[model samples]
Target chain A: MSRELTVVGLSHHTAPVEVRERLAAAAADAEAFLRRLVADCGVDEAVLLSTCNRIEVVTCSKAGHDPRQALTRLMVELSGIGAHDGDGLLFAMQGREAVRHVFRVASSLDSMIVGEPQILGQMKQQFEVSSSLEAAGPVLVRVFHKSFSVAKRVRTETGIASRSVSVAATAVDLASRIFETLDGRVVMLLGAGDTGETAARHFMAANVGQIMVANRTFETAVDLARELSATALPLERFRQYLPLADLVVGSAGGGQLLDAEDVREVLRERRGRPMFFIDLAVPRNFDPAINQLDGAYLYDIDDLAAVVEDNLGERRREAVRAETIVEAEVDQFWQWFEKLQVVPTIVELREYADSIRRGEVEKTLAKMQAISEEDRERIHQMTRAIVNKLLHHPTAVLKGEGSPTEESRLLSAVRRLFRLGDDT
Target chain B: MHTHTLMLFVASACYIGASLCYGASFSRREAPGARLAPWLLALGFGIHTLDIVRDVVSAGVLPVATFAGGFSFFAWLVVGIYLGLQARLSLAVVGALVSPLAFLAVTLDAIVRGDDVAVPQALRSPWLPVHVTLAFLGNAVFALAFAVSAVYLLQENLIKSRHTAGLIRRLPPLEKLDRLSAGFLMWGFPLLTLGIVSGGVWSANSTGHFWTGEPREILAALTWLLYAGLLQLRLLGGLHGRRAARWTIVAFSLLLTSYVAVNLLRLGTRHGLGLAG
Candidate 1:
């Protein structure tokens, strides 16, 4: 039977945001689930791929059965949720299409963010899990290795990975606009939440003059400030220094602490110099009226979302181009897979034909004891020619048909015609 | 005297070996040249050490109480420090360019000695070693800077003119060569300062001006100021790659010309050949 690969899963495209987030596997959890895939699931070879935006399982089987049902059932059992909840979220691709999906994913040509180097490392982890479980055979080893080379090509040959702009990076760009040089500017980093902490770190790397943290809880803010080697002051003290700061990025853990009147008082002291304000908080902390202040640049979460959306669109266009390259590469992989199926038949045909030629030629030579050395050499050359001439047509036909055709018919024909299997 | 002849022959061979190794390195652009560079450097250094040892042994004392003696002492001191730096930095490729100048200086030393020159008793003082050693080491550092700056200038010109080929690949990156040149300046400037100070101390009691006129002092000061300015620009202006490279070449050229001009003036032509005590 011909073996074919199958990828059966939904991703950010097919599923809703909520569904994708729930189905996605964290790096640590994907390994255990990968083992169960081959052990209890109907998978001969498998790799589990999980990232922030998508979760997919790719498998290969000779049985030609739809592995999706088995995989979704496996997902349901692992998740401990009702199978119906994930039933509508499933997507499937078979044979060559499955290989194309895997190549695209490994190359980061299918990620929500194209040319992001992180996905390559994630796919490598999945491959690592499969290898550790002894689930990846020679076929997957070939596919996984080729994926790295294809990824390297897309990275070097295209400008997709160069000069990338991310959200954190955009913040740095915006900061440069406000300050002539970070050589001597002070910042009031209003929160030390994960995103806020990350933004603070970026500010520090740019060599911001100094940073002051103001959070709802003074202790937590102080702790983060000390960790960053920045100073922390009270919430009430924030207004006193707001106008003194060159930049104010308020990711205030929660709630509006700065009003229109409050910012007006702050702006009054700020002079004519520009002050950059980024509110990453959900319920925008700064008054909407504060944005109208002269020399004040304010951006909220929605503005950042707009920037991310624009970038995502650009990412998709390059991803489409990359996808075309990956599809061609995957076709090459399938051709190699196909040739693998034709191997035993080719071997049996050549070996069986050669043995018959050897047996007859030897018997004829032995029967004539007066056969000269010249006659013996002539017989050897003739026997090789006869074998080649007889086997040439069938070998070409067998190798070309390879795996798309049902393999059993060809195997049986080789056995009966040559009586090959009986001797083995 | 025969040992002296043997010393000159061996030192010349060392220079030849170092030049051959460097030429090989630049041509082949491979490990054999880089590997041979250090060995050839060691061979040159070994012969140089033996030559110096034979000189002292043959003379009963350190050979130059005469102008010939000072020349030989300064020559070995310059080349000796250079060979030490080669061992330290593994810059035998640089030694290729320097070794010939070294051989020439030593040959000049031999010629001056063979002329049966008189020993200026005033020149032979406890201060002589300090003044000569510091001056020689300073020159050695300037020589290193000169070689690196020349390489930097060539690499920059090649890249700017968009002509890259085998030699460019063999050379270290521009930033590395620039830093190496700048590092030489940092080292040489202080040694130069000490040499000037010692020379001043030696000349303090003597009458009208010093043994040399104000021009050597002025030129040395000019070189020091240029290097100091270049180093400051490298640090504060964050100047790097080609801009910093060009400055290094300019500074090193000024430095080298100062030494050459001072030496020529010492040999006394129509040019002032200025004064003597």
Candidate 2:
């Protein structure tokens, strides 16, 4: 039986990063795990794919074997977790869904860094490893090649790739596009947390003139200040440079990075030189009302994620184009698959028809007292056409449903109806 | 004439078949079936060989005396050279490129074919074939350079977008396309110069004036100068890659306008230009 292609997995939509991080299959483990899978679960063929965002196992088997249990067992063994702990987290797909899953993954639809373009390489590497192990047979080979073709076609045919945004970097580009220069821009950090540190490093990378680190603590502020090559300021004194720094990043110890009153005081002090406040906090450190201010543009983590997510959403929108591309590629693979079946059926049908035509033409020619050579040739052509017309529809239908599952029944029907294999 | 027409059919069929096969190859990487490209290309060359030989059948009345015959020959050369390069380098995208070019060249070359407008006595000089053939071949090379540059611009954009589509994975890099375009022009320019020079000599002897007869010849010379400047800039100032590719494309567009479009407009300065017009 030809294994159908299938996919089963969850992305950021179904799981948080912490959960995803735990599920991520390290590179070295995947190969060993692929070997263990065949040994443990009677896996005939298999390829393991693990990206930062997605963990999926594609496999084929023969005879009596449970795949979902087999995959779940492999995950537990590789992850060093309780075997049952992964039951709810691991997704299992059987046939066509498995093939379709890999296609989508190769197309960047299953990426954590959506449209970041590294997953295709990762998939190719995994495919190579599988090929090395002799785990991917002909069907898997067709699936991979067709997936690559679909991804290629999607990129060329659709505008999904045309629009993309890196929100973290977009803030910088947008700021520069607005102000025309980041050379002398004063960037203030509101938090001493990682998100704030990321913003500080970006500003430093862009060569911003100065940075002011303001945190809830005087000491932590000093540490961040020295690291960023900027002066450390107390939280109370944060309003002093509010009018000075053109860009502000919030990454503080407090759950809420910044409040509305904090921004209102700064906006009042700035006299409106245009300030961009980038909020890199989860629950939002600043009140969204700060966005309502006249010259201050305040954006939270969700807004930034929204920008990347919008592109991810755009890619999701384009997944239809990607799916359309995959559909055509799938059909092409199927056509080859189908034509292999059709060729034999066509030859058999033509041979069968030829025998009847030849028999009738011979009998008629023998009986004819005065048939010209031209008349005989004409009669032969008429008999051939009638045979072809009579058999065309049934032969086409027979080949159309020539899957081995359907072919057995159809073959029996053809044999019994035509007595094809019976000797007179 | 019947044989000539049959050979034309065979040539065009080979080109069309070669195009489809290569296109399938790009979309199907693992399929050994797409290996038909080399054979189809060889087939085209075989048929094209027959067509060119047939052209020589009527001796002095060479097939290129008609406009279609000349363009078709040039088309075959472009595709033939493209196939040769592909065989040596394993470049698959050349089919995506060189096939359409061969098609257009053959199609356009055949456009004014049936008319067989007699060559004027003045243009019937011994050097006329050499001059005309060289110019058409040079234009064909420039057309190739333009196609390569177009791919360069697209690959550059794909890089900028940071999207590595499968086609992007399959395509030669922008730098390679740029170099190929420059290489084409590098050789093409000198051939064009010889063509123009031979024509200048022919015209001076027979018609008395070259550029004065066709103001467009001056345009062609200027186009040639632009490419010469580009080649010099490429070597001397390291102005290459897309910049050289751009200049080649620009110069070719002007060459095309001067050679084909201007003639179509019947814009000329010669007293006998009116005779052809």
- Model 1 chain B poorest 10 in a row by lDDT: B268-277
Question: Which residue runs of candidate 1 sit more than 4 Å off their true CA positions?
Answer: A13-15, A22-43, A63-104, A128-135, A145-164, A167-197, A203-211, A214-230, A234-339, A344-393, A396-424, B1-186, B197-210, B221-277
lDDT by residue (A92-125, candidate 2, tens digit) is 7764456666776787765664455677888888
The clash count of every prediction, one per candidate, is 1, 19
lDDT of 1 at A214: 81
TM-score of each: 0.47, 0.45
lDDT of 1 by residue, A99-156 (tens): 7777777787776767788888877877887778777877777878888778877775
B1-277 per-residue lDDT for model 1 (tens digits): 6656566666666656666767776665244655665566457557766766675555433454444444455556656666666656655446667656656656665555553323344444566557766766776676677777787777555433323323544555454566787788778778877877776665663333354555677776787688778777756655544466567777767766665565545633112321111
Looking at model 1 chain A, which ten-residue stretch has the lowest summed lDDT?
A156-165
A351: Cα error in model 1, Å: 15
